[model samples]
Target chain A: MPDPVGAVARLQQELTRLPGVGPKSAERIAHFLLSGDRKTAVALADALRDVVARVRPCRECFNLTEGELCPICSDSRRDAGSICVVETPRDIALFERAGSFRGLYHVLGGRLAPLDGVGPDQLTLAALAQRVRRGGVREVILATSPTLEGDGTALYASNLLDGTGVTITKLARGLPSGSSLELANPQMLVDAMDGRRTL
Target chain B: MPDPVGAVARLQQELTRLPGVGPKSAERIAHFLLSGDRKTAVALADALRDVVARVRPCRECFNLTEGELCPICSDSRRDAGSICVVETPRDIALFERAGSFRGLYHVLGGRLAPLDGVGPDQLTLAALAQRVRRGGVREVILATSPTLEGDGTALYASNLLDGTGVTITKLARGLPSGSSLELANPQMLVDAMDGRRTL
Candidate 1:
């Protein structure tokens, strides 16, 4: 209606695309940025740009990284033979925060939802299989969410890594029902990941 | 300490600066941005830059604007004789959403917080007085928040407009006590501003 009062409308439109920001939250943030020093907005913009430009998918695992490989993937001390497969990069962060996983990670980008048109080809299933097939992978833990889609993806991953002598596992049901790895509490995730069950 | 992962750490550091984003929230947002298409990040940064570059305070009322004057101040339909004073531009947004108070707004930038060393001179008090003194102003509505700082600022504004013949008013305490104007619901704010009492 009246061109929506300044850059606030534009800023709100931009901010609402973020993961959790709602219209009201976007409005509040836009107003906060507009009323304060220009530097804060500039800093936010620069950070977004920098992260987009510098952060690339880790080569070995699909976790986000500034380098060719993610920290967990590159660290020799970590057990590379135990790759924890997760649906998204944030899941890796959760596991890392849980501090129970000293293994590398394989980010699937998303779970396999056949009803939604996402299949094995859509995720990092190929890379995960190749990583396992290349030998030395003793265990492959599916840390995907506890949802139906997560279960389907885990089953697919299990099949893909079959006969490789790699023990296939899934995070224990200690995580509350109907929760993603990202939402699981650190202690619960630690318990689940540490006491994972063979699939 | 091994340099802390990758660009995620850097991005999280930047995101935590937003009003309500905590460290955990920042991490989630950072990973979300990095994993998405580049255009999303670019769009967010561009919007921030565009807002920073274009948005300026209305010269007449100090409300945010992409041009010389904000839309409310620029509109010919709004009442010009009545000026509503507020602590921030968001307050103006809240009032506008209430669909009431079709008048100009004077953003005080902040209230007088003596303990924090903020005095009358720190806000837009002098500019407000000048705007009112320039004449044709029938009423000056002091819509500053309901906190101590807000009360102090309102008291100070009332004294400054003394004998100026302009009826000074304060928003009726329809809002919850000890809360800022920004937190007030639209209906409550409308009732408060509509039932404002002359001080």
Candidate 2:
């Protein structure tokens, strides 16, 4: 049959490309957008564009930001002597929401997933090593997810910083296995932060 | 504490505004976008913008289209003598997907819901009535959803077309209650079409 509603069909297809959105959900969203006020549709489009245009990885920490450095990196009040490593910027946001971490963050962009072709070179591992070697950094916290890939990435980073004299710590096991920091409850996250163990 | 990853947090907030996207799903989508390729993000943004810029309701059928008239209204092969009335463009798509309806369509934009302040004025009933009176319309099918609002809208439209001399019919009752034509299985929809009843 002729796809007369081709524009709508295309919209649904594009929406389903996003994670967790299936064909049914995409269709529902397309209908909702078409039925809503024109301004709402326009605003969502603009937000999508703005996010891509204004946001970039922080040069130092890889967290998303509008400027050369992420806000956390530029903030003078944050502890300059400590860095918490994470897999993505969303993890940084989760930690920030709990209001417990006052140190700097280093986003690895992704964990070490050799199966997915992600290696130490693909991540910001060199920048992290350089930061550790530059001195005054008392600790490097491995706050990556507890997944196998996260554990592997942590081990790789720890090995690289073995003789650098900087203390290496990993977040505690209070967080359940296979759980993302992004999905962890605030209390559990706080417990994990408080009970961090030295590597 | 300060939201260090404010950009991601804001992006998630914006995503949750879309229909059927709850907070958890929204977060998942945001993380996906953050981790996804720039081209995918750009494509989604472009699609949203394109839909907003190009799609508008057809003047005659009220079906969404990129021009003054929808493809169904403009197509010469369609049976102009028969008009299938539906509550939304999504419903029109469902009917079209069946590939059996050679008739043109009229989208009511929504069903009658007094509690939601939706009335006959909010619908395309007047336009449909005008179309029915203008000429060669042998039949006007009330294919609105089977819900209370849908039945109310169908009844209201039937009353308006009372003296128009065109035959009035409704899709059969094989469709389950409190469900949408968009969600009906193809066989059930075909059965409803094959077993239509005249009023």
Candidate 3:
């Protein structure tokens, strides 16, 4: 419902479109923006605009980056031969927080989910094959979620890189079998990344 | 700590300033913004900036407004002789959503809280008294929260309007004694407004 005021209602509507924000939370957030620090609200708005306008997917790995490549891909010290593949840029942040995976990362943009019309062409499989074909990659670790879609994507990616000398691996079932990688705690992520096995 | 990338971390930091967003939720929101619907995030950012820039305090009643006065203050159909006093703009929205009130409102900006260093000087009490002294207002309803700060503000406002020939009323403690007017459900708010008692 539109709030008593048009702006409040509009704001509540905008917030409800977020990933996890519901109607009640949207109301609270809208009221807070209207009532709390104007500077804070302005800052958040500016940040929101800036992040979307400025941050782009890295050219090589497709992770969020202000430059041509993401920070991890640009860092010279990270193990260049080992590419830890994840489903999204946020997964990279999760890994970084866990203090695990010193190697580089490749973001698939998303996994295979035909129900949602997400297929092989919808992902970054071609880019993965190209990167592996370029050589020097000793191991390709699949850190996608352990869900059905994630497994299908991993199997598909493995078939694409089958001829390449790279040893393909998947994160151990250390994560709860079907839980999301994004929801894993830092310790759990650390353990999962450490115990990855050849696929 | 700032994330490895400047824009990602900046967005996360900005989100953390919101009322209920913690560090983890900030991270989640920031990442979701980057990866979710680009149009939705853009709209929210625009709304945030628009809300702060456009919604100003109503000139006569000190409630939030997109123009010179709030809807209630501008409407000719409302009961001009009854001004429901409130602690914030959100309370006015809450009451309006209840659809039980057809009177005007006077926002106090905030309730009196001495420990929080908020006093009469910090509120809109002077403007309220001036409004009452200008005459024609038959009932001045106090719809502040039911907390100590709310009661204290109600008492102070009552003292200010003691001899104005206006009947001042407080929303009966129809809400849970410790609940806030802004957080009250529409049904509860309707009941409270209906069961107001003479102060």
Candidate 4:
């Protein structure tokens, strides 16, 4: 028999639109929400609505935040003279979890992908340049991923800040920790050899 | 830096409670919602709330439905005399998808799993017995899965409907279609041999 109530189907349909969720996963999630406590589903719904209404990009750095400025931008203790540039706000969370980087961050919104029609205009490159040109900043670290597009984005950003006098740098690349040398790809091996430093 | 917006954290926390969603997956989903269109998030919330407020078990067969009776139970075209018994409302959907068995269904809520503290009382077995004893039902097909708990639940249900003058049957046990003979376990091979029929 057809599902008499359309709500379950609607919920499943909406769930499939998420990043990696598919039809099977959507069905499982829908069933879980329906079978469990009503509050769980309602709470999730409320949270989604609440976040969508309140969350927006930080005015200064474009990182996601509810207030006018992101937590890093508002914090008095973090080094305002140094900035770390990333492709998205999610990357900032990774750096934060590591508890390293004591500087500010600039979310580029996205990387430079010409094939996908993304260009410098699509990212926050102009804002990053303006912040650096305004002065006081001593360094601008390019922390984008080491993929082809990521490298292109970092190169493009570096050129954009050419005359700003900010010391530009990109993240170091090599074999990841806990990985065996036997499993390292040729490019990783090349990077490890090229980037080897004194112990 | 700490997330200034608590909504994102709350959403990720609640999403982790889902069956297969973990912290990483939840974070991805939360970010997706926060960055995407506001309507998508609101639509999901509405669907979830609508489902929780409306859907309930069919009073007769215990299958999930918005009305007093499920679609199969209310339809006159369905064979009421032949009731197919299953473990959950989801099983009814599987049978419906196959487009076979023009009969009503009885959802037992759950199967007998003594180790997990589930018993006949925890299921809808009492209601099932009541339905069989009410007369007019000619056959009760136990269509539970071929697992240990499923088989045990079927056996217990069969015994409960004894002396009701209704014919008791069960779904066939064998290797599934499109499966290799080499991959079939010893028990499945034995079952296939014992239940063989001449073409």
**What's the number of clashes in each of the models?**
0, 0, 0, 0
lDDT of 2: 0.84
> In terms of DockQ, which candidate is strongest?
4
lDDT of 2 by residue, A1-199 (tens): 2565666778888898988789878877887888857676676777677777777888888888878988899999999999999988778878987789999999998889888998899999999999889887999999988777888999999999999999999987678778798989887787789878899
In order of lDDT, best first, we have 4, 3, 2, 1
TM-score of predicted model 1? 0.87
Top candidate (TM-score): 4
Better of 1 and 4 by TM-score: 4
Candidate 3 Cα errors over 4 Å, as ranges: A1-3, A174-199, B174-199
True contacts kept of each: 0.68, 0.55, 0.65, 0.60
**What are the chain B TM-scores of all models?**
0.85, 0.84, 0.84, 0.93
lDDT of 3: 0.85
Docking class of 3: medium
In order, the Cα lDDT scores of the candidates are: 0.83, 0.84, 0.85, 0.87
lDDT-best of 1 and 2: 2
Which one wins by lDDT: 2 or 3? 3
> Given the true complex, what DockQ would model 4 score?
0.58
**Model 4: chain B TM-score relative to the native chain B:** 0.93
* Model 4 residue A82 lDDT score: 88
DockQ of each: 0.55, 0.44, 0.51, 0.58
**Model 4 agreement with the true structure over B118-155: per-residue lDDT tens digits:** 98999999999999899889999999889999999999
The C-alpha stretches of model 1 lying farther than 4 A from their native spots are A1-3, A175-199, B1-6, B175-199
Q: Which stretches of candidate 2 lie over 4 Å from their true place?
A: A1-6, A174-199, B1-10, B174-199
Ranking by TM-score: 4, 1, 3, 2
